[model samples]
Target: MKLDKVSAGYHKKIVVRDVNFEVSPGEIIGIIGPNGGGKSTLLKSINGSLSLIGGSIFLDDLDVSGASAKEIAGCMSVVTTERVKPILMTCRDVVSAGRIPFTNGFGTLKEEDNARIDRAMELMKIKELSDIPYADVSDGQKQRTLIARAIAQDPKYLVMDEPTSYMDIRHRFELMELLKRLAKEGMTIVASLHELELALSYCDRLLLVYGDGHVQLKTPDEVLSEDLLKELFDLSGDMYRKVLRSVRGEKEEGSTSFFVNRACKSFPCHDVPESEFNCMFCYCPLYDTEDCGGDYFYNDRNIKNCKNCGFPHFRDNYPKVIKKLKEKMYGSGSQE
Candidate 1:
């Protein structure tokens, strides 16, 4: 499937424009951007929810411009992160809904439907959750069930929006692995991911929407290496690495504890009465040299060397100090 000169929006106000992309028969594509950047809007456009204002989408040679809902359903299956309506039924029943596209209006199930249902469960490795109440399962299990349902539909293209939104890090990786496997097995997968690293590693192509009008569709390496992310996100300095870094796992090795300057603040140090927390920070050259007037951030790039400070190990609630410090740091202090 390919999106050609597609401009999608609501009413008359355009959200994202001039998006041209192609999905191979068995490739994984990732659409990434900050919030309100129209990732979801583009997904909806292909999922048959949002109408396109210009350009045409093609599934192989067929035009998507005038396709009916059912006809489109025959080509693509979708699993959105939006909370699916809870049907008062077992997990099996909910996963069975994927077969509805194959069913006639009256909803008759064939032997192929049962075979596909079994394949879906086996593919998701959710035979254990089959008898469990759909509502009773964990979010990860539910997500897998919905994915299984989509697989059961047996559509050529699979569209997912934040499929791992409810999953933990472990489950998120697991889900990505599963999607990659499926793509290798001949399913066209398009997803919008908040996880940059995972997307860069798994997706063959990238679509970055910078909102309003700017959009870039390129190979993952090209987009990630060309400062496109920095421009798209308006980031600079060390913070730029937060976006400019490759989505794949290629981070540089550094100390887990960032060096501190002489007077620079640490996590949350409260002025306690005599004794609360007690720990000696590793001293750096700046402290002995008196570069920072006994502050932690002295003359080092790592902000090392602090003046020796003491605490009595008193009892200050960690949460309260953390809350107040965060409030101070992110609050009106900077502007004032």
Candidate 2:
């Protein structure tokens, strides 16, 4: 897929301008930016859902602007953020609609179409819900059913807007893994992601859309090393530092994870090294955990006393502390 000097927006107003990029086969291109930065507008332009205000987009040699709806649908499948209200349609019925482009005018499904629909449901792990009404399931399940519908289309290119929007942490990772596998199988994918960590880890390249209508295409490393995300998102110094650490999965110099306050009278609260003490978590996050990996004991009234625990204050225990907190909040298998 290729976009050349594309400008996209609603009505006559332009939201994103002068966008130029090309997505090669099997490449995962992530579109990331602040909210309302026209990521969805750009994607709609590329997918031919919205008419381009200027410039052109091409899928292979086929010009998107000139292509018929069926012609475009034959090569590209889209999963937009819009919620579908299918009246009385079963999940399987919704998925079967993906084969419409290849079906006869009467909308009769062939055996091959049925097979593809079933396979798509299975791949999305929604086969059990196939018979349920589309309106009855949860938002996450609806999103998965839509994704399965897109997969059932079997198009060469897949475009998605916030594909992980309604999914839980585990399902979000699962969906990204599935996209990776699909890309490996030669399906080019372009998606807008709100999760910066997933975008940094999974996308081969990022299409950054700035709020000022400027866009840049860069590799993940370039986006990180150049500090483009901070500028793009308009983050403060401290928030930017935290975002950097979160995406890189490494603690950098002057990281937000480590802090010290020496002015307090009880400064050396823990018996640990003052230089390595992290005051970020001044109060132990695991204080409520019954089996917290810390030196804690019950007081005379059976109330827990965490004053002797230094687990949260240790510099090296930041990740451990965060892990314990997340486990307490969302269970051990959670990724959020």
Candidate 3:
């Protein structure tokens, strides 16, 4: 798939302009940017869902703008964030809809089509939910079902927007791994991801879209080495370093266990010495504990108020905060 000088938006208004990129076969390309930065608009243009305001998109020499619906559906599959409310449909019924483009006029499913549907359900780990009502499942299950539906289409190119949105950590990892396996098997994937860590780890290349209609396609290493994230996201010093460390899989080396975001408007949220204040626990970790060992109280609405608490903000209390969190997550006996 290739985009040449493409510009797209809603109804004659251009959101992203002068975009030029090409996605090769068996590659995983990730689109990432701040919210409302035209990532979704670009995706729609690529999949021929939204019309291009300027330039052309091509799928192996065939212009997407002029391609028929069936022609486009045969080559590409899409999974958007839009929720589909299919009344009286089971999860398997929803997945079966993917075969429409390949089926006869009455949409009869053959044995081969049924086999592909079963394989898709298995890949997405949604076979257990196949007999359940589509509306009765949780959001994560619904997202998985939709993914399975897209997989059943058996298109060469897969396009997804925030595919991991409603999934938990384990499912998110599983989905990324599945995408990698698909890419190895010669499927091309283009996805917009809100999770920077996953994009950095899994994507073959990153497309950074700026709010000012500027776009850059680069490797994850180039993005990190050039410090583009700091400029793109306007991250604070501490947060930027933390992200860098996380991408590199490096641990904090020194005795510096605390961070202070002095640039914050709410600097000194608690009255403490500037030199000793620790902003590590900006929101207290012990807020959920009934006996929180901090100066807190319940409001008239039974809300736990920590307006005057400074226990977690002191530099020396870092170990205590970690211990408390461990005890809360595990049993007290598990705390070292």
Candidate 4:
């Protein structure tokens, strides 16, 4: 799919201009920037929801400008940020709606359609909620159901806006993984994301819509610079650096502590509190380290378990932890 010199927006008003890019099969592209940067408007242009003020979009030889709604629906599916309130409609019924383009005039589902719907629900892990009304489901569940609908549509390209907005951390991770799997299976995906980490980790390329109709298209690594991010979001210096460091796994010197306790009866919630038990390192700074040599394991839910690790509790280990953290923060043997 290709967009050439595209300018688009609501009726007679242009929000984004000169947007150009070609999407390859199986590539995942993420659109990101500050609010009102015309991300959604650009998406609308690609999906044919908003009319293009100038230029054109093409899906191979088929001109997007000329394609009928039904023809376009056959190749593209979109999950927008707009919440859909489905009255008296079950989740199954909602997912089945994706087949409208392929269904007969009366919208009857065939055996193949049922199989596709079943597969989509299973893929989204909403099979059990299929019978529940859409209005009764939680926001996260509803989001998943809508995603299931998109999947049931079986379009060659899938587009989503703020897909993870209502999802919990676990669901966010799961959904990204699912999208990656789908992309590997040859579906092109274009999405607008608020989570920079997820976008950096998942997208093959990123289109940054910095308001005033400016857009920059680049790979994640190319656009992950500190200055660009700070400018894009209008972040202050300290915060911009802090956010960058956190995402890059570089700990600031004072971000963690060695030992100190304010007022605590329990002192140690897991076991008897040692007089010297330090509350400073209550949350281990090295929790994110893969080979910190601490005795740690992940629980059933994949949460890190450091209950038996005495590395952070012992007062003497404070200096060593700090040293390791500093080393991680400022590379090994560099003046700290």
**7-69 per-residue lDDT for model 4 (tens digits):** 988887889888899999999999999899898998888888887899999987778888988
Clashes of each: 16, 0, 0, 0
> Sort by TM-score, best first: what order?
4, 2, 3, 1
| Candidate 1 lDDT over residue span 254-277, tens digit each | 122222233645422323332333
Report the C-alpha lDDT of model 3 over 1-336, residue by residue, as the tens digit.
898999989999889899898889999999998888899999999889899999999998789999988899998999998999999999999899888899999999999899999999999999999999999999999999999999999989999999999999789889999999999999999999988888888999999988877889999889988999987777899999987877665222223577778897666555568877777666567665464655665666554546545354568887887887777678699455
lDDT of 3: 0.86
* Cα distance off (Å), candidate 1, residue 166: 0.8
Candidate 2 segments whose C-alpha is farther than 4 A from its true place: 250-336
Clashes of 4: 0
Task: Name the regions of candidate 4 deviating beyond 4 angstroms.
Answer: 250-320, 323-336
Cα TM-score per model? 0.71, 0.76, 0.74, 0.76
Better of 2 and 4 by lDDT: 2
lDDT of each: 0.73, 0.88, 0.86, 0.82
Pairwise lDDT winner, candidates 2 and 3: 2
TM-score of 1: 0.71
Q: Name the regions of candidate 3 deviating beyond 4 angstroms.
A: 250-336
